[model samples]
Target: MTKKAYSKLLATATTTAIVASAFAPAASADSKDFSDVSTRYADAVSFLADKGAEGFPDGTFGTHLSIKRVDAAVLIAKVLELDTENAPASGFKDVPARAVGAVNALKEAEIAYGKNSSTFDPDSHVTRGEIALWIERAFQLEGSVEVPFEDVNNRYKDAISMMVANDITQGLTETEFGVSALAKRGDFAIFLHKAYQAMVEQSDFLLTVMHTNDTHGNIQDIAKRATAIEHVRSENPEALLLDAGDVFSGTLYFNEFLGQADLEFMNYLGYDAMTFGNHEFDLGASADGHKALADFIKGAEFPFVSANVDFTKDSTFDGLQNFEVSEDPADGEIYNGIVKEVDGEKVGIFGLTTEETPFISSTGEVQFQDYIERATEMVDKFENQGINKIIALTHLGYDDSLQYDNDLELAKQVDGIDVIVGGHSHTTLDEPVLNEDGEEPTVLVQTGEYGKALGTLDVTFDENGVLTGYAGELIKVSDLEADPVVADMLKPYTEQIEAIKTQSIGKEAAVVLDGVRENVRTKETNLGNLITDGMLAKAKTINPDTVIALQNGGGIRESIDKGDITMGEILTVMPFGNSLGIMELTGAEIIEALEHSVSAAPTASGAFLQVSGLNFTYDSSKPAGERVQTVKVQDGSDLVDIDENASYFVATNTFTAKGGDNYDVFKKAYEDGRLSEPGYVDFEMFAEYLKGLEKIEPTVENRIVDLNAAE
Candidate 1:
């Protein structure tokens, strides 16, 4: 028979068996006429009589009597409505022809086995432990819960545990599982009854998770997000709302109010949990190191999960964090992990910040541990506590080039994580990505950056906590109506931000400055030239030896219209709060860094460089590491070829100087104390440079030339 047809039959028979055991024996029923049956066994005897079950032909259910293996097989086969007439041969010499088909059918279904290679042992009484294993296998029961029965051996522990978890049986006593005791007919009836009921009620468990990441303090559409969340919760009230961090930087909201404005709306919307993104620690280098972060945490309405981040060394977070998973999590506290019960199922959630945070952001004394090791520990802890459903709320980028970390690597290396809510790369996944290389599948999802969209994932799991099916999508927040309360609360913040948007910086662009993502990341643009020139000029002021400047194309966020530039436009272009740094590197090291800049040429890479005070040419046809043709540095009045062993001072953003975007050469210099950060924020420097410019005219001057491009 087909599996689907058989499953349908089993479900039907399971419900029938449980129904037969629930009701007391009816006085007028002809099936209740068995003389040897007591009230406890009467219902089962009546059910057997109506179904014409085997071993009850003498009008006696034989209450307290042990059932033979063959008779037990016949009863189960009849209840499951298996085709006994067409069953295959048992291949046993001692089996009776009348019961051979029933025993063979049970064997074919993998619910029963022979005592020896050739012996059916049809006459042997079935043991309670044996029955438990058979029932568990027949129905495909799963899960384990602590049980009081101590007599169950290791061999039968899994089956017994599954039975107890399903409420199918409780054993003979509080301390004894009766593994070796004979299965009495009266007791088997109740066991079968509960198993039947459990089977009848079994269906795939459905869970809905709504998530956001890299919001970057863009709360302009938070009201719409609230409406979207309400709509999703209207369908599934138990749906969890999660954030993957980076809500502390970018945009005017962060600069003015720190993270408190975002936190207010987050609390109002009822965020279940949050994890730290690299940008959340942006203020760690300030005089009030991590004080803003601490206040953000203290004002939050939900608990925070951070398995790999250690805030113990930073007194700003003292007494606010616990180092273990919390079963009863409190608001405004941090934990290594948290257990949340949704619709009677326990879901374990833990957080992982990028290990690169120390170099990329101002983490100060807040140490970060290895992601893989900490993730494994969290998984083990949750599993030990009987939690099978797990989620890793992470700021590790999705499919990031960092092999040591990333959502893809985490899913492949970790064993039990079922879902990953990811951020940090600003990836927009239209549908959830699945990594099935491990023992079980993991669903990785992220919404695009800047609060433009809300992501939703609807997943289904079997009784074993195995992901069976899923459907996910990104909902455009702009399409949704703003929630009235959230809209009202946003008025004060928007008014303040509006005032900041209109104030001019007393400079007009002579022409449209090209900072388009496609233009800036692929090749040099006028805006890139202007920005790098500004960096070079500012660095020279700090250290006269700073002769070369480089800016990552990713930092140029928006374009400038050919008109009076406002503070808002400049902040929009360079919103990451990255500061300036001067790095002392050998000429050979400068050449090596330039080679990496064009490695993904023809394809846009965020690591691509826009330079000033120096010019370079590369052949894109050559292999990535061998692409550079020549590099020259400004030497007084002339451009000269760089000497491999000579040292040169190069100006770049602190992010690049500290090895952001996989710049190993620059990172080495930063680590060796060859880098000095004067701490001038990028936008502030750009504003100053624009004011000093004669006429705001900027042009591409072939500073970065790719040889393979057609003339």
Candidate 2:
């Protein structure tokens, strides 16, 4: 889907919190005035400022100067929260008068002794190793990692080991801690900031919001995420759990059981509300083809809010109905918002799905309203109903340039919206991005694709419901222990899925078959080549005249690790259940369709194509409709130009032939009845094609050239 790249572990979480409470609010990149410091230390200086810590006496931060022993006492006294009022009598005789407040406080708090038992080296220059030692003592930190530093004094070696194990510091070099080097003003800021952040990570909070999006059948990680959610509920009884949709595709759990597996966990997780994503309609469009979506709707234990969905026009969403959470939910409250009384606070949560679903998914006879228009209407209605805090749960992507409207645009355009938890773009915000540029400050959070992360946001408000402060972070679902109850529930379901997934299909080359989410959606890959080849061969059986086949890059989910291939790997790579389609198109129409395919080039657009029986060249720097510079059809062993009026038969997925990914040219041809869907399923034939070969080694041969390649 989008960038879900994870970063470093947050501050060591020093406090004794629940084992499941591992959500560390990401360090904000807030800058501060430190004229002598490098920007690398800005985050540290900013954090120190947030804690009301001061700089040098000259009004400049003096980040380049070496820290002295008294300076360490004052900073550590503040970070460790030692009482300063009425300083206790210190056992040290060398303590200076100006530094007495800090030194006595530390000694009274039982965190510091002295250079010896009777003397405090208040004026001595602090060393890196000494600073590490003092920090460990202040935090009462335990656990140690072997350090290879040669210059560390034996007195502070254990302390250095403990700090390193806690991620407080890494050696200056792989083998050197620079133990005797003087600690700089910048270094002290970083050390104190990290300690302060860890101390306050879970102190307390008023309200909390936990959300997920584009889970895509990643049930395993959801097992651990459920534990995190449960811990959040226990911590704050006022917390609300939300999902922004697209819980449908990407694994055998979905393929074999539709959405039953994911829905079961969603229920177990107890989501308060959720919205629909385009992929939710991947299968449901025909009169009776909506069985999967209908079943998911029926299984939902939470409200499904879609202000723009006009299901009355179709029988596909037969049993679904709008929820009423208030006696007077405003004039058009269902369109405006769903009301929830969370800890005596009236919360308004509204839902909005992208209008592009009909073009990218199956909606059958259902119609979608303009997202921006509906969002404005709903926000006004919620406000009229006296709800000041509003949450918009949308399937609209977070700034998708290809779409007419995105989450950022919605936040800026709609007034009174406080928070936006969204999907469809699959963007991961490790920390909530605050958009204060809007009429009312709007906070946005999304936890990319798959069930890899669970996002938690703690928001504080005054009695009047006006948001005052917030802290947020994405907790990685990987590596955490799954809940016992959830794991037991998943055992039987997983066993059945494993039976077919682990079946040996064939062997792949010793190198990885790269179909990574972002790469496939943006460019060509060997896995894409293998997939397109299979589609061409399968379609050729029914229509030997099929000259070329195309596969949408978005349909490829993950990379196949090098080794013996399994049926499960193939399914993971091509999770969508799509059938093959044969169609006749004029050469001009084919070119027009290709133009639409590359319109969102260089940005991981799902419309990007993988093809067989043709080689084309394009320059994305050119205008959208003019990117395709060359087109050639394969003939025997040579390629030749395609005649503009010539009618050529092509093979592709049923989704693409029916206007998925904005392929209007294909949609027009399908409506003209020139397109016929063949009964062969795409992934089944793909598995057979891989097994047919002794070892698969499809290469990228510039079949779809980008003329604007870097020199």
Q: Give me the candidate number with maximum lDDT.
A: 1
lDDT of 2 at 242: 88
Q: What digit string (tens of lDDT, one per residue) describes model 2 on residues 1-711? A: 011211101112222211110011222222455455568788877665554445544456657778778767876765454556576778788876656777898888666668787898877888887787777777655568888888776888888887677676787888898888899877878877665554344222245799999887768666688788877778676689989988876566777788899888888888878888877877764455777887787767777778877776666565465533342333211233588787666888889888867754667777788888988888778778887788899998775533345788888888778889988666778998877767677888898767788889866554566665666889887757888999888888889988978877656656689898888887778888888888888777656788898989988888888888888787788776565677789999989987887888877888989888888888889899999999999887899997779999898887788788989998888666576543355677787688788767778877787788632
Across residues 1-711, which tens digit of lDDT does each residue of candidate 1 receive?
133353444345324432121112332233366667677766665556444543344655566788777777776776665666677876777766666777788888888889865888988899999998888877775578877787888889888998999877778888998989999877776666566557656756667899999887789999999999999898779999999988977667888899899999999988999999988998888989899999999999999999999999989999999999998999999999999999899999999998867765788899999999999999999999999899999998785544336888899999999999999766789988878878788989999777889999876666788876666789999999999999999999999989988888898998999999988998989999999999999888767888999999999999999999999899889977676778889999999999999999978988999999888999888899999998888898789998889999899987888788899999898656576644456887898799998899899888899989944
Estimated TM-score per prediction?
A: 0.57, 0.54
Which residue runs does candidate 1 get wrong by more than 4 Å?
Answer: 1-201, 504-527, 533-565, 571-711
User: What TM-score quantifies how close candidate 2 is to the native fold?
Assistant: 0.54
Residues forming the 10-long window of minimal summed lDDT in candidate 2: 1-10
Displacement of the residue 689 alpha carbon in candidate 1, Å: 7.8
Clashes of each: 0, 0
For model 2, state the Cα shift of residue 551 in Å: 9.4
- For candidate 2, give the lDDT of residue 264: 87
